[model samples]
Target: MEARLETEVCVIGGGPAGAALALRLARLGHAVCVVERHAFPRSHVGESLTPGVWPLLDALGVVDEVRRGGFLPALESLVCWEEPTGRRVRGRAGEPGLLVDRGRFDALLLGAAASAGVRVLQPAVAQRPERTADGWELPVLHEGRRLVVSARFLADASGRTACLGGRKQMVSARTLALYGYWRGDTPHGPETRVEAGPDGWYWGAHLPDGTFNAMAFVDPELLRERGIGRRTLESFYRELLGRSSLLEAWTAPRLVGSVLACDATCYRDTVPIERDRIKVGEASFSIDPLSSSGVQKALQTALSGAVAVHTLLARPEHAEAALRFYTEDQRSSAEQHAAWAAGYYRDARSYQERPFWKRRALAPAAVAPLEVRPPLSEDGLSHRRWRLASDAALVDTPCIVGDVIELRRAVSHPRLGRPVAYLEGVELAPLVDWLGQVPGEGLTMPQLADSWARRMPFRRSVAIMGWLYRQGLLTEVTADGPR
Candidate 1:
C-alpha cells in the first residue's frame, strides 16, 4: 500500500542545511517534513567549521550539545601559501574552531531536527517533485513502500544535485578535488595544514576519529590530459600528495579508502527563491573550498532561509520583500567569497604563473572594490563636528525584523554593502533621521554620541558612531568648512 503524508514545508536532503531549516521551522510552530536520501551517520565532506559557526550554533540552541560531541578543537592552522616556508596562524585565546567527524556531526544535527518535532523520513529517495497549485508533491521510495509527500512550501537542500532544477551561473574557474583518508603510525598535529603547489593546492587535517584526510584541488583538464582513470586514480592522488610539504608529513602513511573526486567549482543559482519554493546551502550556491567555510555558509543560509520561508508562508503581503532579501543575500555572499578566494589565490607566489592559479587569480567583474576609510585618532574624533554625508540617504530595504522579513527604512551609502537596517540589534533608521535633523553646522562627536545614548547603551552608541565613521557615512565639519 502507498503511504501519503502532508506538511506545510517539505525539505529534501537532511544535511546541515536541511536539518537546520527543518528544526527552525518546526520551532516556529510550522509543520515540517524532511526527506533524507541517506540514513543518519552517513559520511560527508566539509568537516571544518570556522569560529563564526559558534554563534549560529548558539542561536540554534545546539552549542552545548556540539561542545559535548567529542570533536577536536581547531587551535591553529599551518599554511604554506605564499612561500615554501610555512606559517602558523592561531585562533583567539579562548575561542577555537572545530574539526569534526562529519558523519557523526551531521547525524547529531538530524537528530536535533527530529527532536524538535519535525517529521523525518530517512533512507528515502525522493524523485523529481511535481509542482502543485499550492506547493509541491514529491514521490518518495522508502522501505519497500512508495510514499507521497505533499507540502505547501518546498525547500531544496540537496547540495550540488540541486533537486529543484535551476541554471547555475559560474562564479569561478572550474575545479575538481581529489581526496582520500589515510592512517599513519605517528600522530599528525591537530592543526589544519594548507599548502600551495606548482599545479594545485593541498589541504590536510586530523579528524577526531584517528584518521587524516588529505585533499588536492586541481583543474579537471589536468586530470584528463594526464589520462587519469579509475585504475590510476589512487596512484595519481598519492603522487600529488608526495609533492606536498605539509600533507606528506605523516610517517608511513597508508591509504585507508579509495580515492574520491568531486567538483569544487564555485557557482550560484540564478533564482534562489520564489513565492513558494526556496533553495538553501549548496543548492543555492557553492563557494570555493579554499575558505573551508562551506559548512558554516550552509548553516548561515539555512538560518536566514528559515526566516525567508516563514515570511512567505505567514506574511504573504511581504512576499516580494522576502524574495528580494534572500536573493540579494545569496548573491552577495557568493560574490564576496569568490572575490576573497581569487585574492587568496593571487597571493600564492609559488605557482601564480601556472594556468590553474592564473585563471582563478582575477576577481569577478561584479565584485565591487571595498571602500576603506582612514583611521582617526581619539583627538581627531573629538575635535571635529560631524554630520551625515550628503551621499547618505534613507532607502526602503528588506530587513530581518525579529522572526519575519519586513520593509524598513535603511541607511544607504556608496561605501556600505547593501543597506544598514540595524546595528548591534538596534534600529538605524531613527538614528539616521535624528542625525539629519541636526543643524547645518552639525554636532560634535560627544554631542552626537550622547544623543544616541538616550536610546541605547552609551558604549553601543559610540560603537555605532565609530562604524558610521569607518563606513564614510559621517562627514567631519572642519575650519575649512565640511570639506
Candidate 2:
C-alpha cells in the first residue's frame, strides 16, 4: 500500500538549501515536508563558507549548533593569482569564515529541520511531479515503499539536478572541476590556498576532519582534446596538481578517495520562481567557484526563498510582489557575481594568454562604466548649493517589508544599479521626495542636512545626502544653472 502525506510546502532535496527552507517554513507555522535522495552525513563538495554566512545562520537559529560542530575557522587565505609569489590574507579578528566537512555540515542542517517539526523522508527519490488545481502532487520512493506527497506549493532545492527541470541560461564559459581528497602530513598552515596556473586555477583547503581537498578547474574541452578517460583520469589530475605551486605543499599526500569531476560552469534558471513553485540555491542559479561562496549564496537564497514562499502561501494578495522580488534578486545576484568573477579573472596576470583565462576575463556587456566624481570635502560640501538631478525620480519597486513582499516607492536613477527602496533600514522614497520639494535655488549641504535632521537622525540624513551626491542623484547649482 502506498503512503500519503500532505503539506503546505513540499521541498525536494535535503541539502543546505532544502533544509534551510523547510526549517524556516516550519518555524513560520507552515506544514513542510522534505524528500531527500541521500541519507544524512553524505559526502559533498563546496565546503568553504564565507563570513557573511554567520548572520544567516544566526537568523536560522543554528549559530550555536554550528559553532559546536567542530568545524575549522578559515582565518586566512594564501593567494598567488596576480603574482607568482603567494601572499597571506587575513580576515577580521573574531569573525573568520569556516572550513567545513560538508557531509556533517549538511547533516546538521537537516537534523535541525527535522527537529523543527518538518516531515523529512530521507533516502527517498522524488519522481516527476504533476500539477494539480491547488498545487502539485509528486510520487516518492522511500525504502522500497511508494509514497505520494501533495503540497500547496513546491520548492526545488535539488542543486544542479534541478528536479523542477527548466532550461538553464549559461552565464559563463563551459568549465569542469576535477578534485580529490588527500590525507597527509600538514605541509602548509590552516589557511585556504589559491593559485592561478597557465591553463587554469587551483584551490586547496584543509577540512576539519584532517583531510585536505585539492581541486582543478579547467575547460571541459581540454579533457576531450587530451583524451583523458577514466583509466587516465587520476594520473592526469596528479599531473595537473604537480604544476601547481600552492597545492604542492601537500607532502606525501595519499589520495583518500577517487578523483571526481563535475561541471562548474555558471548558469541561471530561465524561470526560477512562479506562483505555485520556486527554485533556490543552485537550482535557481550557480555562481563561479572563484569566490568560494557557493554555500553562502545557497543559504542566502534559502532564507529569502523561505520568505517568498511564505508570502505566496499566506498572503495571496502579495503574490505578484513576492514573485517579482525573488526573481529580480536571483538575477541581480547572478549577474553581480559573474561581473566580480570576470574582474578577478582579468587580474590574474599569470594566465592572461591562456584560453581559460582569456575566455573568462571579459566583463559582461550590461555593466555600465561608473561615473568618477571628486571627493567632497566638508568645506566644499557647505559652500556648494545642490538640487536633485533631473533624472532622479521615485518609482514603484517590489521590496521585502517585514514578512511579506510589498510594492514600495523607491528612488531610481540611471547611475544606480537598481531602484533604491531602503538604505541602512531607512526608507529612501520619503527622503528623496523631501529633497525634491526643496526650492529650485537649492540649499547648502549643511542647510539641507539640518532641515532633514528634524525628521531623522542628523548622521543618517547626512549619510543619505552623501550617497545621493556619490550616485550623482544630486547635482550642483551653479551661477548659470544646475550642473
How does model 1 score by TM-score? 0.96
> Model 2 TM-score?
0.98
Q: What are the clashing pairs of model 1? A: none
> How many pairs of residues collide in each model?
0, 0
| Residue 305 accuracy (lDDT) in model 2 | 96
Tell me the TM-score of each prediction against the true structure.
0.96, 0.98
Task: Please write out the lDDT profile of model 2 over residues 293-333, one tens digit for every residue.
Answer: 99989998999999999899999899999999999999989
lDDT by residue (tens digit), candidate 1, 270-351: 9999998999999999999999899999999999999999999999999999999999999999988988898899999888
**Residue 355 in candidate 1, Cα distance off native in Å:** 1.3
> Where is model 2 more than 4 Å wrong at Cα?
365-369
Candidate 1: residue 333 Cα off by (Å): 0.7
